[model samples]
Target: MQQQRWWRGATIYQIYPRSFLDVSGDGVGDLPGIEAKLDYVASLGVDAIWISPFFLSPMADFGYDIADYCAVDPLFGTLADFDRLLARAHSLGLKVMIDQVLSHSSSEHAWFKESRSSRDNPKADWYVWADAKPDGSPPNNWLSIFGGGAWQWEPRRGQYYLHNFLVQQPDLNFHNPAVQQATLDNVKFWLDRGVDGLRLDAINFCFHDRQLRDNPAKPPEKRTGRGFSPDNPYAFQYHHHNNTQPENHAFLERLRALMDQYPDVGALGEISAEDLLGTMTDYTRPGRLHMGYSFELLTEDGSPGFIRRTVEELQAHMTDGWPCWSVSNHDVPRVVSRWGQGSTHPHLASQYNALACSLRGSICLYQGEELGLPEADVPFEAIQDPYGIAFWPTFKGRDGCRTPMPWQPGNGAGFSAATPWLPVPDAHRALSVATQEADADSTLHRFRRFLAWRKRQPALTAGELRFLDAPEPLLVFERTHAKQRMLVAFNLSDQPQSVALPDLDSWHADTGHGLLSGHAEGQRLQLPARGVYYAVAPAA
Candidate 1:
């Protein structure tokens, strides 16, 4: 296989730059900090590291609101520091993938500043700008993910500029050829700098309805999968006019073409739409993105049936397209915290890490997931995420998942000498890296073991998945590659369960690094709580 195509079934670890580590004693993680920890990250056995945005930004939406796509944020070190981080990671045999927020930019960006100044400037049409309605209202009924209307009035231009997120993060006008070319040019700058992959943020929001059509209303039942709190009014509509436009495909094709010029470069898109599975399929077609992931598995549901059905649906739609699965990221609550229901369960984390990696597609493991860290309870006073601050009491913001990583047991958690950007929860301290490294049965060790073992199983890494008929609390599937076939089963609940299997005469159980041991007796398989079973059969 070619080196650039390594993401086919690879596991990529995600590092939230602000929370990973801090070496400058500035209370925030920087590129030098990430460089210093490259060895530890490589030890996790992940093939690549997909870092969140570290570009120059005004911090309105953190790094997602980029002020300069090609410049490194001062808070995160200089461009030279990033070069060192990349060099260090490559030396350790880990590919580096950085975030690229192309759909929008911080209002303070030079392009946006000039575009919003006057309608006749050279960069006037660089961003999504439209005339107000007869009554001086927004151009359309589209709503912002952070709350309120998606259109913000710019008195200087006498028009409204669109912003799917916060007012400070304005959407780019991809309808303009110049805007698309400029975005592609910005991407090439990074490609020349030697990044192995790009994780495109909010990729579907690149284009909008040219006619400025009003989006139809959405019922409460159909508003759950758009990657926002149900309490947010942004979920009340179908979002037809605001995002997931057809014209975005052309832009993606252009971006992919630019990437094709550089060997071993991959593009992963973050897509969230009304029909997320269908959209993921469309966005990752042959000439488009190499892979895409949505909020399907990131929701509140973690049941066996839901997981099985979600994968089955995506597999059905994505015949030639590749899908990426992530159980947790910087945007959502930690998987252990979300699925564990306010409790910490090392067993659940172990099962989740295995299941995510064993799926039929690539995997993205978030920071601290290996430690089985639950979501921190960031108080309102400590909240820094604008999305969370906007919907405070009803839905606490994402600050919980963005807290600093706990490396040790004492104050500062070995992350920094000063008070960190976010408080390190006491619960996380109990599961710190230092503590887990000493315990043989810790989730951290289990994670490392599973990844090492998984690398040796071709059927688990790059095989076709077929789900077997199993009841609740039991997820049974088969992965086959070439002539190698393996039967994989899991008991998702805390209660013991048993499933009838075919004749066991031709099968032998393979204990996979003691993740969870299950046994077979005759034609029945016995699985304890959160148990896993992997058996191999001779080629027919």
Candidate 2:
């Protein structure tokens, strides 16, 4: 039973369908395009593939604003195409996980349309609706992560509707027991269709504060994180009342129970509450989600101290729960550019990949990450994301990291016959799959080699992790499982460095992973710029 659980210590590759590939010639990627690329993805040695939202939607927040939970969006393909894609993925020995955005639905959804019609409709209490104040002000001081007030006026109901994101995506009232069962029924539909897993989006925001209380103010000095700009007002509040309610634990248990009925299926929740570490621990405890991940490492602070402290803090909080670590996703800039300080270093991508996978948790490697793709330069005229269009120059939106994957060295890069929704970066053309397939020392090849080798090492996969104290530019850790113990060290710098080993008699270097080379001799070990060292010894 333990070995049959494929999600533990697995590396999941996230596929942003819009930018992965396109076969319909409709200027957008679809299910058929993903099915066409299964061979390429399975060759990377990943255990599963997580496809982002392809559900029916208006594309207001892209596919995150789901209109129909049980059907495929025509922009992507028909339901048959999705079925075919699932069959192909399973045949390739890869589990398929789809995104589930149950926190909210598109305003265009039939349920939302009916709920907003009148105060006494059949589904009137389906969404969070509240009466305005005597002065016609919003019901509370809650703010949207995208912009100003979280409430919008609904003239028909004579009330305000809450939306933590864009106005088109309305928040659902999970306080209603009926709403919870409906969401679970939707999950049952997919599971019946042979889906292996679910990646829950904004799972922490499913239940808001029922009292409708105003959030407390946050000091200016304390508003530096949460992946928002300093100018964005959403970061000015403590965000206490808007999300992360205690009621969420009950819903999680219900969802987990439903998943437990199906063999080998897991739920990986995306949590970003005011206290991310604590929430990660609470949400993934026994009888809850199988795994949880946050945006701690996805931020701009990638220093050695910050990285070590973040992991150590989370480890302290999540003593028994499972965690999933990722540095790049559809939301933030690529790790190569973000961690490299707006510049590209030769071995930085390899070092980042190895370090992230070496951590004691499951890993999520975003599309194009293996190619070391940098953030693209999408001009204002070509921008389509409302988030980018809203904050024009100051904080250009997420389009830079969501460009189409380059597959060849030509103009189109074989992504599509028609122009993609987003432009493929010219710099990425050199790192295309075809170009890298022929090069022996390309980042793509190194990624594959490392993953293939890491699969054989039990200590590196499902073992206990202990950090060995080291200065900046050096992250050292030890992993032990039963009788197998492994020591891993990474130099996240552009200059050469050396570290003294504690147990010379017990350690021998492992050079099989084959990305960076480090020389080990006696008590002293020399590592080149952006290099790593791996060694194994008997369990202490």
Candidate 3:
């Protein structure tokens, strides 16, 4: 394995800091809490840990609306605490990656405040600002992912400012060279701190259409997708003018150049657009971002055919770009709840984890996934997400997946001494780490065993992937590395299924947890419910 480019084909664990653990007794997780859990994270057999935003903020969109790129929020601890966390992770052989929310900033940020105060200020062009039309409407027909109208009026300058997300988050004007340099300088601040990598939040939104053109309306049939509910007006438009612009590539090239100065540094971009695979491929081309991941697998559709088609499409379009696959994260519902459709089978989470890691690129495993935790049901009163509040009854927001991690079966779930930011679900308590650690056959153990096993299989980790023809509810593929080929198959449904093998005489099964109750007889292979099969054959 290459030490410098360890991110390639690596399994990165994502930690939602606010809910991971809270040693501060302030109902929020902190850097000290994360440092204390480094041993636990290392035990998972993951290569790195990606911590979500803990930057200085006013808690508007939690930590996404960053107030200061270089400073740590008081709620999350100080700069020294962050340094200690980094040291602890490195001591445990886990690379550390922090979230960089460079696309926008809090309205209270000094830069945004100075920019909006007057048009002639030094930072006047730092944020996206435009004059209203004769009817005093927005400058364009763009909609915010959180709700309606992406433009917000600022009385100080008497101009409408673009905000693709919460109104409190004003989009930065990347068209200005000074603004681009400032963002790169902030990134360099972390690189100087010895951090291994960055998870670039909304990387494609760094630039906008210079023409400020109105986004074309989407047909009613094509309205439902990631980021917003069907009821949200944000889904009404094609969103071409607001994000994924051509100029963004130049900015990414500059960012990549800055990263190249530091050794062992990686950039993983989060992209979402009308053509997600296309955007991912473009953003991750050589001399740009090292890896890019989208919400194709994060959607409500979890059918085997949909998953296969999504990967196939990306494979067809991607030239030399690498992809980072993730099934669940801070922004979406837990995979088991979204895909299992209320099924409590112990194998569901394990199957999803295996499938995600088996793909031909890097992987991100969200926290608590190893424990098979389900999404918590956050009531209307306990909702903390502004996006959920705007679309209530129809959509409950991301609070369900943002709930506190369950470490033990106690009231606090061993997350905090006091009440957590969000209530910990009793169902999650039943799947606590303490309980799973004691059970060898538990999902937690299964994930650990599978990941450890996956690390040993070069074909599954760094091999080229080719899909095989299989029936519904069954996915079959072959992974080929230098002189080594492995056949991988999964029964993605709850019912048993079977797939035909091309040559059974030369293939032998790789024994593991995923192959439970599966056997090959001549040209036919039988798979039990939620079964996974791995077989090795000499390269043809």
Candidate 4:
């Protein structure tokens, strides 16, 4: 259980490679359909497998738009199927991590087709261009989050580039130091091909607004429930000059000095800031990013006073940094169908996924979130999400939590013998993975016994949370360390509830011994209906 900080309190299972598994029948997902589901994602005890981009793309913004940050996307396979998915995910001890997108590319990149073939190539200023103004409009008022003008033009470099999303991607101009050393040599060519880590994508859109200014308006109540939409005018402005730039913190210290030259190679970063937890506590403090994640609980809120004031403002601003907690991914909507509204309610998605692996960071689930797999109403002529076909029905994209991953209850739920690049929802074909691998109180076996008892809790893996003074829809806490403490509680309501641990004075009910045994409280604890409770703090 004390395995060299195996990514601290790790869980990470994300995978979205065009719907995770379609081994060459051409229905999409490949890499031998993720090397034939790397033993079903190493039987879901996940210590790693971040994936998400399969590179070589004109996918407009799919493989987050790279046209080859070193090959692979022949519709997702080859490089000997990503070296047999890195030799079967390092012989199933897991750890792989992938998606690097590096803030923008795919304007058919070959360095943006030689930085838009013009103004004296040597990669003509490598990308955020400009010019237009004094009459010809766009060189400023930036907007685009896939809807309007974040300045496009580029008539073979007459000027105007930027694109905060899909004007075929664009952005990348870390004010050039050979484009941040060829993007740290495409992350040292995937850590010289063994990978092991990097999620980076949109790491603060890699720099802009070198005073080619103009982002001011934003008002409809300071708009923020994260993913900007109020009829999407890119949430009416205030993106104060195209992105969070302070020269992208010296290009994230040259991408954390090329992920600190490799030993156990890590780098998470995806912080799409709008002050995202203050740019994820200044990009993971010590060495720019050994971790970073935000879209804060990927929204559709369930208020316990907004998840206790966003984990009390990320534990009063992450002191030792490290943050990563996603309640669902593949870009939102699937936290049990946006917080159990599409209800199948396996004990309220196992007490909100054991309150998202007893929060304190490093969590990531996604991939049909352990078979409680909601959100799949997909319609719009079988939409393949160009940001939900550009904001239709108010805003229904993200292909209903990026389809596919059903794994058998019949038909292509086994993820394919064919047909899958999206449509699967017959309510996730009886919640498959061969019907929750023969259901033993399945929510995918309570997420493999809540990630193997949170990998034997060193105070829920690297401790220090505090918050225990509960109330509305309850939300206690504890987590300690240097020889254990634990506690954690929640009910976030659905019906039966109660909480009075009397400051946990006589605690021992280790929640029925695994994800807090669906807590029942003979000494006072009945939580079912979005329930959850954890215990261990006794020694005063």
Candidate 5:
């Protein structure tokens, strides 16, 4: 497995601890709970698990805001509990990648507290502190991703500290070499502890423009990039000076050099910028991140052309760096709801999973993805996300996608002994693990079968991809590795479709994935609604 470079073309499943499983009867998921479900996770045939932030936090942004980098929060358990979780996951042959928020830390963090205490405190310059303009305004016009201006007034420091997201989460001064080294040291701590890898959160935001230049305004017609909502105001301008600075590459190299010391350890970064795919390319170059993914596929556009363009564009520039693609995560609405015309189509989810896994890069499958769970309907009364509360009706934020994972059909959906933090939707309960396990033809079983079957195909697992010309609702691609070449096709629509391959000497259809299989009749392949077809040339 060491020679295999396990992360390449790997399937990494993401688990949001707050909603995954609650073993402590506190209505929140914890490390021990993740450990308790290690076997279940392994059963899905994923190569690794990417656990969202479980570090010590005040829960302002629900674990994304870090108060202490080295300690685990009591809400999720202690450092010893993390050790146990790591041990059990490794014992099950699954790598564990934990989230590392390097761009910002909670205001409650001792470093930020000291930095904001006085102008010349020991750690005063540890954070991004800027004096107000002569007119007593923010140094520049920058908007927080959550809402409002990015600057938060610090009365003690007599300046405004930058917060790209929440006011409580202040950005660090990475331009200062001390801050850079300290952050890398924190990363070294986890690698030293034997975690398989790190999921660098907002890694590109580590460095801001040193000049503090004003961000150029983006025209209204050209105002769509990261999130779907226009009400958030973050999408109003081109985020040039705020993040994805040129100096950040050096820091990434430093981080990479640190990770290279650990055997087979890697970093998967989350990139969100004006040029999403282009920045993803830039961040994942040879000496930078091992792999990087963006919010491109997480959008509402689920058309065949859009998906093709995204992968094709990245593949065009993906020379030495690697790519990790995710169709669903805790940050956005569930793909089944977002992609399948505002509803959950079971067949569509199955086809989409196979399609995403079939792509050339590594794959990240969110927790409820296996069961084809759609976005849960979280009402305003139940909303906890601050971002959601800011822009309620127009944009519900990410609460729908962060509900508890249902393990059983009843009794708190087997998630907790008490009322869960987020209510487990009745629909999710019906598609719980226990319920799906009993059904022979469930989406969960299909998912397991596809992943298990995929591991045996080198062409599907680690191969070069080329998209073939096909009509709408049909995505056709070829994956070649060593001597094996595979032709993978998917019907993205609910209606059956057919595609003509036309130029093949001998292509044999493959099976065992348990989806709606397609047939290859003399270069003419017929696909059922949401069907998947796999074929290989004998000489290939």
Candidate 6:
């Protein structure tokens, strides 16, 4: 296969290190473990793998809080281990994209340590610091994404520092030219090391309102919870001044310039904002990020109307910019459980899985998505995510989705010799890689088939999306290129239904043949409950 510059049309897999595999008996995942599994990952037919942060950290926010921008964490293995993993993945024709945390740094970082040492220190201005008001309150009324006021008072400097996340993860003042340059340099350091691309974590939060103005309270209806927490007060405000600032565009362009220096190195931004679709559009225009994705499909809704509406909105809003869509990742519950209506019906699972690829953008498949793995139920004691711990029961935390990948049915699910970090769900153990690998009709097998089939269809991969009008519970659309046109229809219902072709002379049903399981009808197609169909329209 030849390489392409635009990875926006690519399928990338996300790997959560601690829960992926524990190569060493330390009961934690390491680089060597990921390297060893490259073959398994490559077999999935995805274009690349976006490995979660493996940098030096106290694991406060897992790898999100960076202690060192350049060094691999000792727990994840030395830098040499990462090099080995990178080399192996490249050799297997798989691109490696690493997560880059730019918005903040751990308080333990040398810069923060030095800056907080004293107000007159050389690095004192490296981070955002403000003096308390006469009343001894925070400088302004900004709140952290994890809850409470964003400002943390530092007794040493007699000033408060801003933290958009955990108190330990202090927000870096990107408004400072030095800080921006330093962060860009860190990105170039990795680009020079042969890494294929970067997945910018919290890109919108890189810049904040310079004025530190108070954020407005969100309307009662608009206060539907975000990733911070369900009951966390962070959800009450509209987050106007804290994040999604206008200055992020300037920083993104600078980062883009650095990435463009390398021929094939790409950048994908993770936009977590109230107006995600708008943010994605702005971030992915010509000179900004190569691609971007939002949390539109990550929620618990999977109705055909919701899916169609999301794609329609993106198509209308995202003009020249490309889109990368993912329904589940380490942050959210698996789609199988999220949208499965609490049933393990194979048809429903297959329908949802197909919908992931049918959308008009690059697709992202999390580690265990192939097995139709439902979200694991981790007891409160087993929960390790602080974000989840703070809002237990109401939001059970992300640990359920971060469980180790089930490679086999043997001890530790063949992920490690000792006990794994998170317990593997019993339901997932039976649907292990070994079991699915042997079943030709399994979801894993369908993914490989779909990718292989989709590769040959330029219309499906690189063409434009045109939504077709249809009755409720039916998603109808067409993906078209120069001379090829593919009509994709999916039945999101449990009961059978039929869709009549509006205007067609002849059509060939390609379902159950190409691109996973779907069929075609001459003019009218009948769909089984939760069934999907992909057909090719005859030449006009």
* Cα lDDT computed for each candidate against the true fold: 0.89, 0.90, 0.90, 0.78, 0.89, 0.83
Give one digit per residue, the lDDT tens place, for model 5 in 358-471. 988889999999999989999999999998889888889889999999999996999999889988899899989999999988999999999999998888788888999999
Candidate 4 has its poorest 10 consecutive residues by lDDT at: 512-521
Give the alpha carbon lDDT tens digit for every residue of 67-178 in model 3. Answer: 9999999999999999999998999899999999999999989999999989999999999999999999999899899988999999999999999999999999999999
Residue 526, candidate 6: how far off, in angstroms?
0.6
Please identify which of the two predictions, 2 or 4, would achieve the higher lDDT against the true structure: 2
For every model shown, what is its TM-score relative to the native structure? 0.98, 0.99, 0.98, 0.35, 0.98, 0.96
Q: What residue runs in model 5 are displaced by over 4 Å at the alpha carbon? A: 1-4, 342-345
lDDT of 6 by residue, 29-118 (tens): 889999989999999888999999999999898889999999999999999999999999999999999999999999989999999999
Which clashing pairs does model 5 show?
none
Which digits, one per residue and each the tens of the lDDT, describe model 2 over residues 1-540? 233368889999999999888999977888999999999999999999999999999999999999999999999999999999999999999999999999999999999999999999989999999999999999999999887889999999999999999999999999999999999999999988988899999999999899899999999888876557667889899988889999999999999889888888988999998889999999989889888976899998888889889999999999878889999999998889888885567678888999999988999999999999998989999898888788778778899999999998898888999988988878999899999999888899999999999998899789988898887888888999886899888888888899887775478888999878787877877888889999888776
C-alpha lDDT of candidate 4 relative to the true structure: 0.78
Instruction: Please report, as a residue range, the 10-residue window in candidate 1 with the lowest summed lDDT.
Output: 337-346
> Which residue segments of model 6 deviate by more than 4 Å?
1-6, 225-228, 512-522, 538-540
Q: Residue 499 in candidate 5 has what lDDT? A: 77
Worst 10 residues of 3 by lDDT: 510-519
Candidate 6 matches the true fold with a TM-score of 0.96
Candidate 3, backbone clash total:
0
Better of 1 and 3 by lDDT: 3
Mark the 10 consecutive residues where model 5 has the least summed lDDT.
1-10
